[model samples]
Structures are given as C-alpha cells and as structure tokens.
Target: MRWSLTVLAVMVTTGCTGLELLVYPSDVLRIPEDTLHNLTLSLTFNTTQAFDAALNRSGSVLVVRVVPDEEWKLKIVNTPVQFTAQEVTEAACKTVMVSGYYWGHTRLSFYLTVNHVDDQFLPGVLLRDDVVVVVDRSAKLLDSFFIMGVTLFLICNTVNMGCQLDLKLIWQVLRKPVGPVCGFLSQFAFMPGVGEAPVTGCLHTTSLTISMFQFSYLIGWLIFEDPLQRLGLFTLGCCPGGILSNFITLLFSGDLNLSVTMTFISTLSAMGMMPLWMYTLGTSLTSENNYMKVPFANLAISLVSLTVPTGIGMFIKYKRPRWAEISNRLIKPITVLILVLFGAIGAYSSYKAFLMMNGAMLLAGLIITVAGYAFGAIMSKLCCLKRDKIIAISIETAFQNAGVCFIVLKLSLPTPERYPIMGSKDGHQASSVKFMKNVTFGPIGLRTSLWG
Candidate 1:
C-alpha cells in the first residue's frame, strides 16, 4: 500500500512528461530509413508593383500560393512567416522551401496576385520573389513538457490551500445592503481608464478607459479591422477576477475568508456573466455562418479545477490547521521557483515574438494592470468600506483570471483553417504571457495604494 501511494505521488508529479510524449510523438524527428534525398523548391515575388498604380489598380495586398505535384507529400517550412512590402522591395525577391517526404521526383507551381482592402483581385502585377524550403520535422518536445508542467504546478499551488470559508461571516457581510451593492459595482462597473471621465454612476476615469478600450475593439471589428486580434482583447476585458486574488489578499494581510468567499462568488457568477458579456459585446463580430463557439466544457472544467482543490483546502483548514499553515508556507517558495522556470522557458521559446512585440503590447499590459487597480480602489472608497475590506475589494477587482482568458482564446478564437493565416495561436500565447507578467504589476499597485 505504501509503495502504491508513493507511485501515485510520483506519477502525479511527472504526468506532464507523459502528456508531452503523447501529444508530440518522437516520429516528428524520425525520417523513414528508406527515404531518398531531401527536396527543396525556390520561388520569387516582385514588390516594385506596390508603387505602380497601373499594375496595382486592383488592390494593395499581395497573395502568393504554391501548388506542388499531387504525387509528392509536401509541407511548407517555417510556416506563418511574415513578409512586408518594404522587405520585399529591399531584397527584390523572397524565397521559401518545401520538403517532400516520399522518394520521388515532384513538380511545383505558383499563383500570385494582389488583393485590395475590399477583397478585389488585381491582375498583371508580377511579384519577383522566389524561395524554396525543406521542412524540418524536429519538434521541441522538452519545451512543451516544461511549459505544461509549469502551468500545472502553478494551478496546483494556487488551489492547494485551506479554504476558510466562514459562512456566518459571509452571510453577515452580504446581509448588509452595502456589501451586495459593492460586490456588484466591483465586478460589473469598475474598470481601467484611458483618460478622464465625470465621476458619476461608477463611470470614473479608469472605468471609462476600460469601457472605451473594449468598445473600440468591438467597433474596430465592425469596421473590418483585425477581427481576431480585437476579439482577443475584448475577451481579456470580459474575464472576471482570478483565483490569484485570494493569494494577493493573503499577501497584503487582508481578510482571507472574505477573499475566498468573494472568489467563489465571482467564479460562480462568471458562468452566466461570461457568456452574457461575450454575446452582448460580440454579436457584431461574428457572422451567422461563423458564430463564435464558446468553450462551455473548458469553462466548466476551470470551475471544477478551482472548486475541487479549494474544497480540499477547506477540509485541511478545518481538520488540520497546522498542516494547512505548512502547505501555505511551502507555496511561496514553490511559486517563486515555478515563476523562474516559466520565465526561462518563455524567454527561450518565444524570443522572436518578444523581439517583435511592440510598444503597443507593453502599453496594453500596463493599462490593464493600472486600470484594474485604480478603478477598484475608487469603487471601494465610494462604498465607504473599511481599510481591510477595501484592500480585499481592490485586489479582487484588479486581478482577472488570465488563465481562463487564455483558455478561451485557445479554444474559441480563430478556426483551424485560419490558424496559419492569422497566426492566432502564437499571437495569443505571446500576448497571454505578456498579460500575466503585467498582472504581477497589480499586486505592486495594490501594495502601493494600501501604503498611500
């Protein structure tokens, strides 16, 4: 029995390795023993056409398509590559490679055209860009394992706490008219600001900024802007407070019981609110044929993932307070270790995206963090809450469930066919990491607000 228990513990700790191997098979790196020489293709495009109105009479955008021989199994190398008119103009031509799996002679074809903003095609524009690529099937299985393991460990740590849900205390707080009112305003009304606003009906500067950001994204989509990117930003704004709110509350020596209770309330409330917010704000963003598919299963899973561990923690607190205290003490160091590991893995894997990330991304992260903290404080102050409760509310309002938002992005946004076209997967992953890093700024803001 002892041996079995030990085995279970080890399996639980190392499950991510198994998951990685299953998801990213070694066959990705293995070439068939009987394979012949590798295959490559070269292609060209002309960028000078962008300057010629007579040639580009149809559109400003360039489209390139490659057609390989039906007998050959071909794959594009370094897919989702970005190219600009300036790069093409400077180089005069661009080349891409395609790798063939089978040992046989194959033929290749190219179709190039220019597209206008209205999706009209322009003919007679020759782009002088040619490239061929050989596909490298080498997969980064270790990186995958590391990222998944770190995420699991972080979630486990966040949930592995004693739930001190004081029913009587929660009831007393809610029974007061101010408590319910404050909770409603914090979740629904208080938000970050872009600029100034009249302080009336919860529409302060911070809240106005947040609202404008969300609304502008929706409006942008309506006006045929980058719809997928705008959808991602809108979803981030819609997420409710995260489980990390409880940890921040504890860190600031605020009311642990109240924090836990509010987290529970908000999470349960999100089940309804999330879908409602998405539907209300995103109706114009989707077509009737391609309506946004909400990941109800993932939402349910997130709720279960949070509640089950919290219930266990509550049991520990009630039955084993000393053990709970020890577990809590251990979490701090473990969290730091996990963060360091995450940073290394993220930096290594996403170095290119990090370089490509612009000032707009940093500004977005900063605004999300600052606005959450500032508006939350304003709301709490308006409610006339005491210092401790005010601190709890502020933290709760500022820290959103970025994990849940990421999941939604992964599951819902950008269909499989459009993944490569939009580079949605990589874009979201980078943005999610940036958003999480920026979220750390909230606790600092909270601490500063408390001191002030």
Candidate 2:
C-alpha cells in the first residue's frame, strides 16, 4: 500500500511540472491570464461590432486585414484574395498564416480581441490588423523590356553608322577659327538672360528654342496652374538638339556636313550645358526641396553609348565604305520597323495615361513646334546665312531632341501620389508622343512641302 501511494505522488508531481512548463508566464502575456482573458473578451465583442458596422457602411474593402498572433505569419502575395468580415474573423480564429496583395496604398490598423464562448479552456485570440502591399511586378517587367529594346536599337544604330560624323571635316572647320565663332554666336546670341549658351544645336534645338519661348510665355502669362507642369514644360524647352536634325537637314537639302558638325559639338557641350541649365533654371523656378536631380550617370552612359556606335560607323566608313553604304541601305527599313515596334510597346504600356490627356497638353505641344519653326526662320534670316545654311540653321533651331526631353522628364518629374492617374512616367511618354507627332506631321511636313 505504501509503495503504491509513493508512486502515485511521483506521477502527480511530474504531471504538475509538465502543465506549468506548457502554460505561458503572466509576464509573457504582459498581464495575469485571467485579467487578459476578461479584457480580450470585452475587446472582441466591441471589435466585431465595429468591423460589421464598417463593412455595412463601406460595402467593400479591398485591403486585407489580418489578426496578429505570436504564431501567425503574415505575408504579401502577388495573387489577390477576397474575404468577408465574418470569413476574416473565422480565419483569424482558426489559421496561423495569412497572405494578400492590393493595387494601391493600404491603411493598416490593429486591435486585440478574444472569443469567450467557443474557447473555454484557452480563448480564440484575434489581434485584428490591416496590411498594405504594393506589387510593382508588371511595371518592372515593362521597364525591363523597354530597356532591352533601347539597348538593341542603340547597338544596331551604332553598327550601321547611320549618323556618322566626319572628324577630318570637323577638324578643318575648327582650324578655320571663324567657322566655330560664327556657329557659337549664332546659337547663343539669340537667347539672352538664360545663362550658359545652348549646347545642343542639333535635332532638339527647335523644340528647346520653342520651349524657351513657351517658358517666357508661361512665366509672363501664367498658362499653367501646377508648378510641376510648368517645370515639365521648361525642361522640354531646355533640352539639347539631337542627330535627327542632321536627317531633317539632309531631307531639306541643307548643309548636312555643317549640321552634323554642329550636332557633334552640341552633344559634347551637353555634358556641361544640360546640368548647368537644369540646376540654374530649376532652382529659380521651384523650391530647393523640389529641385530636379540631373541623372549625370545616365547622361554619361548616353554619351558613351552614342560615341561607341559613332566610332564603329566611322571605322566601317574608313575601312569598308562600299559595305557601309550597303549596310545603311539595309538598316534604314529595319530601323523604321524597330521604331514602330518601340512606339507600339510604349503606347500599350502607358495607354491609360494617354487616354487621360487633355486638349491643353495637345495645344501646348503644337505651340512648341510652331514657335520653333518661326524663331529658327527669323534667326537664320537675321544671321544672313546662305540658302542651304539658312535651311540647316532653321531645322537645327526648330527641332528639339524629343529623346532628351523625354529622358529629362522621366528622370525629373515626380511620381503620382495616387495610382491609375497619369504619373511622371506616363506624363513623359504622352508628352513625348505629342511632341514627336507635331514634329512629324506639323513642322517636318511643312518643311518638306516648301523645301523638298
């Protein structure tokens, strides 16, 4: 009998120790378990009622609300999930894991609650919480493809030497001394108070020249209310000329060599001019906090990329002129096709923003183009340039580099605070398209009619 009692006592002691080990300490709960239980029960009743009221009032909530628990693992998933308040409550009580994703910014809130009736021994604790997860997978994918296509285009354009610059002739023009001076004066003299001379005298000149006109008009007239829009317009105006000027000059039977030389010089000048102009003008226009950060790395990359292709083209011309000629002929159609594809892809990605565009944007774009042509003509005539040079000057002065303008806008403009609206990226794309359209159908067409 004594042995049996001793064994029973040992068993009871072991069982009590095991129970103590399993039970969480009161300190871990941050309060006594009984007190916590009572508080949790009260909170659960209030929270459930509040959530039900919110559901009825709003009709639907896109954001995911999770109950925080010590063991529960909350995460964001690409795939979307839908659940009612009751369903969420049940899941909170039963599940240890929850995952969800939403499109826009989400608001998160947490409240602790407990089920008193269902869980008698250990109540079902629910720490209700809302979580926000922004998924940029689609945007990332589109950006990747866009970058890849641009890289390919750059490689192909370089290999073909589509806009090969002649160093020997450039050297000859520089040696003349008067030629460089005259070119510099012609570019810088017309625009005053705008510190630092225009660096890009190529394709972008016309757009930029017109943009200067627009900037003056906006500041003097106050056409746009938003400072961001005004800033964007100013940036477009200030962008340097591009190689497109050479092509346009060629099409018009203008001085192609002079245009090409000017383009090369202007592009080289951009390394300094772009940053200087942006900083000086940008500071005056907006608060220092909102000042646009120039992408110097991107600028350097652009210069290097263009230079490599140009160098390759020059090499081909020197070593194999006949082959280079054949390649140019072959590449022209391919280049056109690639451009079309790029346009289509760009349009597809930013269609929503394009659709949101207003008449004011289109009008602004048109004004920019028309003003460029008018100013270029006046400047060329004033300079007393010959017919071919005059045409070249006019073309150079009128057409701004849409690519540069687009890049500046992309880098500098602010992202939309809200989703599904025309943000910085979309705004730039839409504006670029509009500018290109005006150049193609408006000024270029008119120039062709008169000169071609």
Candidate 3:
C-alpha cells in the first residue's frame, strides 16, 4: 500500500511540473491614440531549467504574440518575435519590446507560448479611451477663426438690424406691452415647464400613487442621471432670448424691432428670473457647490454685444439716411452669410460636442424647442398680436442665450461633467436650426416688409 501511495504522489508531482507558468508586470500604461508607443513586457517563468527545456524544444527560441480581440484595430510592429536562449534576462525577467499604433480606444493583450504549452495572457490595456478626442492643432485654429468670424458677422448684422429699428415703433410696442408680456410668459413660465416637465405613467403602474411633484422629480432623476446634465438643461430653459433671434426674425421678414426689444427685455429680466429659478429648481438638482451665482458679467456682455453696435447703427441711421438704406439692403445677404458661418465654422469648432449626444438628451431638447415655438405662437395669437410680432416672439422663445448657458456651465461643473453638457447644448442647437429652416421657414417664404 505504501509503495502504491508513493508512486501516485510522484505521478501527481510530475503532472504539476509539466505545466509552464508566466507572470506579467503589475503596472499599466496609458497611451494616446494615433501615436507610436513602446510597450515593455517582462516575462517571468518558474525555473531556468524549465525555460531552457522549453526553448530547446522550440528550436532554441520562444515566440511572443499580441492577441488583441479586434485584430484589425490594433497594429502591432515587430510582433510574434523569436528570442533565443542567449538573450539577456535581467533580475530573472526576460523583457520584450513591442511597438504598436492604434487610432481608437482598445485593449491589447500579449501572450507567450513555448513547447506547445500556452501561458495566460496579460489583461488588455486601453489607450485613448475617451469619447471626446483631445483637441489638436487644427481644431484650435478652426476654433479661433470661427470665433473671430462669428464676432464680426454678429457686429455687422446687429448694426444693420439697428438701422431697420424705429425708436417710435419700439416705444409704441413697449407702451402697449401685450406682445412683450406674452413673450415673457412663454420664455419664463411655459419654457421652464417644458424643460422640467415629468413623465406620467412611464411604467404603466397602477398600484403606485405618487404626487405630480414627486413624479416630476423622479422623471428628472431618471432622464438626467448626471447632475451636471440636469443643471445644463435647466439653465438652458431659463436662458433669455439671444441676439440670433433678431437675425432669424429678419430672415423671415418678422418684426425685427419686436425681436430686438424682446431680446433686450428678456436679457434684463434674466438677472432676476434666472436667480429665482436657479434658487428654487436648481438647488434640488445639484450640491451647494453648483449654487447659481447670477452671471452679471456674461449678462453685461450680452447686453453690450446686443446694444452697442445697435446703438451705433441707430446713430448712423439717424445721421446718414442713405448709408442706413444701403446697410439695410445688405441685411438679407449678410444674414445668409452669418447662417452659413454658423453651419460651417460652428461645425468645425463643435464637432467634439456632437460626439457626446445620446437619445434621452436629444428627445428632451427637441421637446423643449418645439414646445417653446408652439407656446409662443399660441400665446402671441391669444394676445391679439400681428403675424410679424408672432414670428418674432416664436423665434425669441425658441432660441435661448446659449452663451450664458456655456458660461454658467463653466462656472458650475468640473471638466469631465462640462463636456457632456456642452455636447447636449450643441446637439440641441443643431437640431433647432434644422427645425427652423426646414419646418418653420421653408413653408413661409421671406416676407418683404419688416413689420406687418
């Protein structure tokens, strides 16, 4: 019995010794995409004699292969290398250098096999795995050009718009104040509701009885899983009309005066209403660190960008009628040019923002923009406003001052969270522009008169 047991132990030990073992280094390295990187893999085996025996069986050489899941995605240079026994092993580790190039984020695994025995592979290491690629040289140049070009266009457009403005007509509209009041309600009241509205009967649940407020909170929580995203949407909804509305109004032959007036009033009102909304709804979405500080500087900039060139144009119109007339005639061509720049240069600068769009945010943004347009149109009609004024109000209500939104985001969130919100804003802007051009403006061609 003792002899049989001893033979069995020897057989088990022999079976265990027959297997080969390899240990990889515990460190991980992260490299950029589309860049060359040298990866050093150190291989450690159980015993030198075992290594020698395996090498001898494999013609005095061992092979190291890169085993990537997507073979085509990872390009390995100097792979499947053969190392002879004479290659130096420092500190009991045989180091192999592998060079590779990858344009995207992926994991690359390495494996070593000798004497028909397969050793375990290293866990795949990821390179350049972020959804938004790093901004390189070309993007920076495009962005700078975009900024300068858009600024020039806006100044020219706003000045031309100012030439068309009649102070008497503006005062008359303000004195009556019906159209402006409706626009204010649409921007502050209905728009916020559209942005913060909750889902009802989402799960089709019968037993659960929840309040409207609770359901709203629950829906917001689910839709914006990230706090920063929720803040972005909320701030976007609360933002006042931007200067872009004046251009859109001019394009459609709406009341440019009403558009400019509404933009100015809304921007001013934001100092108060923005704080109120942020204090009430914004407090619930994020921590105290994100507490909304009324961005007075951005608001001042918005006011200056809108008013100064406009005031200059008003002066030019008051002093030089022919010059004003010439500038006024150029409005359509310049408006077209500005729109084109928004599409072309804006796209180049904001392509990274496009990559971060997702289904939930897309749906919400569409809903808000469409609903704002519908609300503005309805409210203006109820207020007994003219068609031109209706067009102005609708455009104003639909497009928010995204610049302010961006400033607020920069102030409130960290780098990681800011990216997704900016992306959401960019996607929303692109979709809104498409909706306006194809659905709204295409049906009704540009009207000749500035005011109906």
Candidate 4:
C-alpha cells in the first residue's frame, strides 16, 4: 500500500512537471539569410530534370545535401524530392531553406523558384527568386491564447474562485440510509482509467489546471455551499470515481447499502449539474457588459468525448463484472501512463511555441498557475468554507481543461485568416488568400483556459 501510494504520487508529480515543460510562445528566434541562400542552392543544384525515353514523358528528381556546411560526412545517400519542378528550371543560387532553429541569434529558411527564359536557345545558367518566409500572426495569436488561459488560471487560483462542492455532506450521505443504494446505483456509471485526463493534455494546459481548481473548490464548498447546491452536488452522474469511491467506503463502513446509494446519487448529480453549472459559473472571464461564451459545439464535444467513453465503460462494468473489476484495477497504472503521454504532447507543443518566442509566456504561465491556487484558497475561506472544501475549490480554480479550452479556441478564433476571409469582399475566394497568408503565420496551436 505504501509503495502504491508512493507510485501514485510520483506519477502525478511527473505528469505535472511534463505539463509545465510543454507549451511555448511565438517569436523567439530570427530567420537567417544565409540559411535561406544555402537551402535554395541545395534544392536547385543537387536536383535534376530529365526527359524519359521509355515512358516518353518529362520528370524531375532532387538529391539534397543533408547538412548545410558538412559536405563530406553529412551527405545523404538518396533523398527523394517531388516538388513542382516547372517553377525551378534554374540552376542559380536563389533557392531558400524553410527550416528554422532557435539555438542561435539568426534563424534560417530555404526557398526555390523558376526563372522564365524567352529565347529559343536559353543560357546555360538560370536564376530566379521565390518564396518569402515571415513570422505569421496565428503563431503569435496562439501564444496569446495560451498566455491568456494561464493568466486567468493564475488569477482564479489566487482569488479562490470555482466550484464549492461539499465533501463532509458527501461523507455524511455515505453514512445515511440511502448510502448503500446510491453505491449500487453508482456502479452503473463507474469505469476505471478512461476519463477526461488525457483530453485535458491535448489542446491546452488549462483543462488540467481548471480541474485541479475545481477539486479545490469542492473542498471549499464543503463549508459554504448552500443547502440546495449541496443536495444537487451529491448525486452522481454515473461515472468511474462514483462507484469506486463507494466500493472503497464499504470496506470500512458497515452501512454498505447506504454508501452505495449515496455514491450513485452523487455521481448522477455531478454529471447532470456539471454542464449547467459550468456554463453558468465555471469561467475565468464573465461580465454583464460583455462575455465570451463557450460555443455549444465545444461543450457538446467535451461531453460526448469524455462522458460517452465513461458511460461505455460503465456499461461494460455491469455487463462483465469480472472484466470491470480487472479494468478498474488497471486504472491507476493506465492513469499514470495516459497522463504522461498527455504531458509529453502538451509539453512538446508548448516547447515549440516557446522556441518561437521569448520566455514571457513561461513566466506568465507560472505566475498564473500560482495565482489560481492562491485566489481559490482565499475565496474558499471568505465564503466560510472548511479546509477540505477550500482545497477542492483551489484545485478546480487553478486547473483549466486544456482540451476544452483548445476546442473553444479553435471554434472562436480558428485560423488567423478566418477574420480576413470572413471580412473579405470575395465570399469563398478569400479562403485561398487567407490560407496562403496563414502559412507564413506562426503556429496558433490551442492551449488550456484557466476558467470554465
């Protein structure tokens, strides 16, 4: 048991660290002119075009040097190339490389283009200029989104804002007449490892942050939640944790039936109320003057993606009790693995963003994360909540569902050219320009929001 506990702690810690490591901002490196020049030369020089005899058709192929300066050691055996060749009938040094690196002050890119010649007997050498690389706005915008989410999460965490669910009441309910019944009912919806954790890591760090904040809020709500809210929160929406908690409780408490029933009730209520409550109050940004409402589409996606899988797991749990038990047992291990994977992806995306920009985003993210926890704790105490309730609220307020936030970001802002195309005079034709312009833009990848 001690080893198990230790392992869980380590897993959680590692996941958190991974989450923190990923998520970078845009505009951190500069593209070098020399790199571009080299890329251009490599593409045009190492490549060739031929008129086929057997097929009676024209074709072109390229073999590029693997490295810029390492002519001997870095040469590749055979690098296949299949770019539009008609544009590159030139052998000049006007080609460019599109790759960028952040280790140095100057970043580099590659480009290649064709030079048109009118004479029947053209010159032996051809030269042309093509392809321009610039920092795209979408990349910056994505940085902003991530920064905003992190900022809001920190603020909420600092202010102690989030769901204030009551735990003591829950425990009390477990000891009540319907506890066992609730526990039994909860079994219907409880699955094991599969849940929202993985999704949280995909688009934004906010989802994970927000969830922790919610947990904090629940702890806080234990003391301050209104009687009505308290009752509403206890009912289960038939999810994994519901039955698992109830089953665990039965080991210690004689009132197994009461524990079971209460668990069921809590699970059901949590699911039903989660959407409504989140829509109403679960956000970092809200105001009567103006507000950014999460679109219906994103909400639907989250519910479907997260809840349905759990529901299926629940169904499996009941249909195949032994299988369910086995699956449930695997939850701890799987949880660790999935979380690690999520952290890896999120961290990688974040790191890429970071390379593009300065350390401002990282600093901002840290500040916000800290602020979220602080505020959540304060709010819990001010609202007359107990320590446990405060803990829950703080967790919820601090962690935003990155997956949900990513979805929301994609729907709201989408591509940088979305506005240009939508605002353009050409109805659909605007898309082409918008897409082209977007390529030059930086990565506008999604990150988690701190609030609902």
Candidate closest to the true structure, highest TM-score: 3
Q: Score every model by TM-score.
A: 0.56, 0.52, 0.64, 0.35
What do the candidate models score in CA lDDT, each in turn?
0.46, 0.43, 0.56, 0.30
By TM-score, rank the candidates, best first.
3, 1, 2, 4
Residue pairs in candidate 3 whose N, alpha carbon or C atoms collide under 3 angstroms: none
Candidate 1 lDDT tens digits, 80-157 = 222343333333334444444432222333444433422344442322212111221233566567656855774666
Model 1, stretches more than 4 Å misplaced? 1-125, 128-139, 163-184, 190-227, 328-337, 340-344, 410-452
Q: Model 2: per-residue lDDT, tens digit, 3-30?
A: 0000000001112111100111111111
Per-residue error at 139 for model 4, in Å?
16
Which residue ranges in model 3 land beyond 4 Å of their true spot?
Answer: 1-139, 195-224, 416-452
Evaluated against the true structure, the overall lDDT of model 3 is 0.56
Question: How well is each residue in 38-100 modelled by candidate 4, as lDDT tens digits?
Answer: 232322212122211211222332222222222221222222223323322333223323333
Q: Is candidate 2 or candidate 3 better by TM-score?
A: 3
